[model samples]
Target: MLSEGQRIAGQYTVERYLGRGAFAEVYRVRHRFLGRQAMKVFKHVGSRAAAEELLEEAVLLSRIGHPNIVRVFDAGIAETPGGRSAFFTMEYVPAGNLEQYWAARGDRFTRIGEAVDLLIQICDGLAVAHGERPPIVHRDLTPQNVLVGFDDDGRPRVRVSDFGLAKRTDAFTGLASARGTLAFKSPEALRYRKGDSPAGDVWAVGAIAYLLLTDTLPFHDDSSPVAFFGVPRDAPPPSPQIRNPEVDDELARTVLHALEPNPARRAADAAELARLLRGWRNPETRQ
Candidate 1:
C-alpha cells in the first residue's frame, strides 16, 4: 500500500520515511523547485469530502505563523495507489523530536537554565496557537510532537507539530476519534465525548515538563484513554523535586497549576501560562 520515491503534486519527491502513526506517514522529501521539505502524507483524508477540508487547514495554519510553530510551506494532495489523497509539505526540522533529545541527554535539562529555555519556547509556541481569533487547542503536547533544534545563529528552537489532531475553541475536529494523547489528556477530555481548550494544552505541556524534571511520567500508564480522564476525582500529582531536587520551587508550582484537575483553576490560557513563567524568571519581581 506504501511506496517510495513517490512525488506529490509533481513537485516534491519522497526522500525517506521519517515516522508513522495511526493516521499519517511523514517523509523527508525534496522539491524539484523548492528544495527540502518534510512531506506528511495524512492517511486520514481518503475521501472527497476530507480532501476539501485541506483549504481550512491551510487557512488555519497560514493565519498562525510563528517561529515556534512548524512552518507550512505548501499543502495539497498527492496521488496514492488508490487515487488522489492528502499530503502537506512543511519545513524540515533537522533535530528530530524532543523526546529523543531529552532521553539522550536527561541530566543536562535538569539544569534550571536549560529547562527554563525549553519551557519559554514552548510557551511562545502555545501563545501563538492560543492567540488565534477563535483560539486553537493543540489537544496533545506529548514529547513526540515537539521538535527541537537550533537556528543558524545557534539559538535553540522548539517547533510544535501535528495540527491534524488539534481543535479550535469554537469547533470540533471532524474526525470521529478522541483527539489527544491519553497521558496528556485533561480531566474533562478524559470524561467527555470531546475535550479541547487552551488550558488542556497548558496541562499537557505541564505533563511534558513533569516528565523532563522527574524522568518519569506519574499519570502516564497502561489504560484506555477513557479510563484516565473518566475518574479524575482522585488524580494524584507527581513531584519533580522527588525526581530532581534542582527543579526549584517556582517552576514546580507553575507546572502544578497547569496540571490542576479543574480547568477553571488552570492558567487562564497559554498566555497566562507564559506570563507566569516570564514573571517567575524575573529575579527582582520574584523577590
Candidate 2:
C-alpha cells in the first residue's frame, strides 16, 4: 500500500491508491518530470525473486509496442515500507475497463456498429502481438483486461492491458499452462488443455463481440458446473440475433465463425478477424 505522499524509484511520487488486484496494487503517481502515470506495484512483499519475475513482464510490455496496447514507461526495483518491491509505470487510461464502460451504458442495447468497432480495435492490438516473430498470444482476453481510453475528439477508444498471462507461442511450457479465464476459453482449448494460440485468441474476440452485442456469454448456462462442458455438442451456440434482434445476420455469423470448435476452422488470426469486422457495412447514415 503506497501512501499518497510517498516517493519511490527516485522519481514517482504517489498521488493516490488506484486499485488492487490478485498480484498487484495500482496507484496514481506523479513523476518529477513525466507528469501523471499509473504505477503497478507488486504485492508479494519481501521477495526479491518475485520482484525479478515481475521485471520480466515489464520487459515484455515494453517490447510489445502498439497503439492499442498499454504503453510501459519505466519499471524497476524500489525500496518500500514493507520491503523492496517491483513496480512499473504505464500510460494511465482514464475511462476504466471495458466491463465498467459497458455497465455504465446501462441495460439498453449497445449499437451493433459501435460494438463491432470496439472489437475491431481489440483485434488490431492483438494482431500486432500475433505478428511478432514467434507470435505473442494474449491468453487472457476479457472485458476486465480492456481499458477504454478516449481519442482527441473525445470519442471512446480502447487499449488492451494486463499482459501478465501473455506467452510466446514458441516458448516451451506445459500444454495446459497457456490458458486464461474459463468463460472466454475456446471449446478446443477447454477440451485439450492447450495453451495460447492464434485460434484461442480469436475465440476470445468472438466471445467479447457476443458480450458487447447481447450482454451475455455465447454459451450461456448456469446449471452446469463446467461452462465449456455444457456447450451443446448437437448444436452451435445460439446466434447473436437470438438475444439481440438488432444484430445483422452477417455480423452475427462472422463473430460465431471465430468461435468454431475446431481451431483449424476458426479465423486464422487476429488480423483476419479484424479484417472481417472492418467489412461490416455501416448501418447508419453513410459518409
Candidate 3:
C-alpha cells in the first residue's frame, strides 16, 4: 500500500490508504490541480502482459463513460513499497460503498422506495455496458463495488465501480466465464452451467435490492457446501415481504423475477429490470 503523503508520477499525492482487493490496493490521492481522487494500484507488475491486464479496467471505464459509473481520470505506472506497479486514478466518493451505506442505516431497513431508486440507478449504469455492440458483462456486482455518495443538492447518488472482472460477452451466446461473489451470483453462474451474462448481472442487482429492503440476503450462506454443489434448483429463495412487510407485492415480484433460477425466465438484462422498477409507484406518494 502507498503510504500517506507519497507522491506518484509527480502528479498525485497519496492522502491515505483506502482499501485493497485480491489484486490491487486503493488509495485516496490529491491531484496536482484537480483535488482528490481514488488511485487503484495493482499488485502484479514486472511484465508487459501484467501491465496490460492492469490497464483493462481503465480502458473499460473510459469506454463506458456515464454519470452512474465511476469516472477514470488517469492511468500509469507508479512506484510502490512492493515495487513498480500499474495504477489508475478515478473520482473519490466520500460516502464509501453501498455496503457501508446500508450498514449506516443500523436496525432500520432502507426504505423500499429508496432501495428501488438505488437499484434503478445501478441498472441504468450497467445498461450502458450491456448495450455495447458485444455487451460487457460485469461478472462482479457486489455491494462493495457500488459507490454511494451525494449530489450537489445533497440527494443520494450511486455509481457502479470496480470493473476488474468485467468482460465483453460472446456475440452469439452473450456469455463469459462465470466469476463473482457466490451470494450474488446467478444459479447458472454458481454451477458454471452457462457462464455469466447480462441476466447474471440482473440477479446481482436483485440480490442487492433484496439486502437493502430486507437487511438479509435472499441466498444467505455464501460458504455453504451447497454453493459447491450449486444452489438447489427446487428450493427458491424466500420472498422479500417475509422479512420486510413494507415490500409490496409489485416490488417483491420484481425482486423475485430478477432472482429466477432460470435465466430465460428472469428479466433479460439490467435494461428490462430498470423498466420494471421504473413502473413501481411509491406507496407514500400514491393517492
Candidate 4:
C-alpha cells in the first residue's frame, strides 16, 4: 500500500511496491546508507504489543542466518498513510522469485541438473531451521516464497524467503499448525491428521522439484472437485517421468519419495533431501 517515494521512519525510501499477501505488503526500498532492501509491512495497524507480534518473522529469520536464507536487517513500527504499521527490512534480490524463474522457462522444463541444484539449495536453507533446538517448520514453502538471484560470479543463488508462517515446533508434539498452499502441502497437513512437521516441509520441497521437472503439480487435477479440498489421498501421485520422459529413474525416485503420502515414508527432512539430491549430476555435464 505504500506509494513510491514515501519514506518510512525517515530511514528507507520506497522505490516500488513489490507484492502483497493476506497479511502484509512488500516494497522495494532504499536504505539511507545501506543501499537497497525489501520492506515487508504488516497490514495490521495497532499498539506496540501488536506490532511486536507482527515482527516475529524478522526475529525468526535473524536467528536462522544462513547463506541460503534471506537476511533481515531491521524491524520497527513505521507510520503509514493508513496508520502505524509494523515493518521489517531485508536484503533485496533483483531476479525476483522461483515462480517467475520457472515460468520464464515457458514450454521447456527446467534442466534436470539445474532443478536439482535449486532444490538442494532450498533444502540447505531449510535444514538450518530444522536443526534448531525445538525444530522450526516452514509451514509455507512454495515457489513464490523462494527468491532467485545471481551471485557475483553469475551462478544462480536461491534463498528461502517469506517466513511469515514459519514457526518453531512444539517441544512436546514437535508439530505446528497445518497451513500452507494446498498444492504443496503434505497429505497429513491437508487432512489435519498430524498437524505439520519437518516432513511436511520435505513434501513441499518434493512438490517443487516435481513441478520443476514436469512443469506440473505432482497430484493436482483441475477437473476434480476434490482438488479444491486437497490432493486425492487414495492414490499416490504419478512419477515425474510419466509427464516428462527426460526425467531419469534416479531423479524420479528421489522426487517421488518426497511426495509420499505418508510422512513416515517421505524424506526425513530438508537436510536428508539435500543429501539425496547431491548425488545427481547436472544434465548439461552428465558424461
| TM-score per candidate, chains pooled | 0.89, 0.90, 0.95, 0.94
- The all-Cα superposition gives candidate 3 an RMSD in Å to the true structure of 2.3
Candidate 2 lDDT tens digits, 1-287: 78989989889899999888778889999999989999999878667887888877678788988888889999888987778889899999878999999888775475677787789899999999888877888888999999998999987888898887787786554123456787787776665566458778998889898888888887765235665553452245789899899888789888888877777778978999888888775534222
Residue 168: error of model 4 in Å?
1.1
Q: Candidate 1, residues 186-222: lDDT per residue as tens digits?
A: 7767777465678778888888777777777757553
What is the alpha-carbon lDDT for the whole of candidate 2?
0.81
lDDT of 1 at 269: 79
User: Candidate 3, residues 1-287: lDDT per residue as tens digits?
Assistant: 68888889999998999899998889999999999999999998777567866899999999999999999999998777777799999999999999998788675554766788889999999999999989999999999999999999988888999999999999998998888788888888888755799999999999898889888888766788887546663355899889988888989999999988888899988999998898885445332
Task: Count residue pairs with overlapping backbones in model 4.
Answer: 0
- Worst 10-residue lDDT window, candidate 2: 227-236
* The best candidate in terms of TM-score: 3
- In candidate 3, list every pair of residues with a backbone clash: none
Order the numbered candidates by TM-score, best leading: 3, 4, 2, 1
Candidate number with the higher TM-score (1 or 4): 4
Clash number for every model?
A: 0, 0, 0, 0
Cα displacement (angstroms), candidate 1, residue 25, comes to 0.8
Ten residues in a row with the worst lDDT in model 1? Answer: 170-179
lDDT of 4 by residue, 1-287 (tens): 69999989889999999999989999999999999999999998999899989999999999999999999999999988888899999999999999898777675554777888889999999999999989999999999999999999988999999999998888998889888787888878877644689999999999899889888887756346566445585456888899999888989988988888888888889998887888665445333
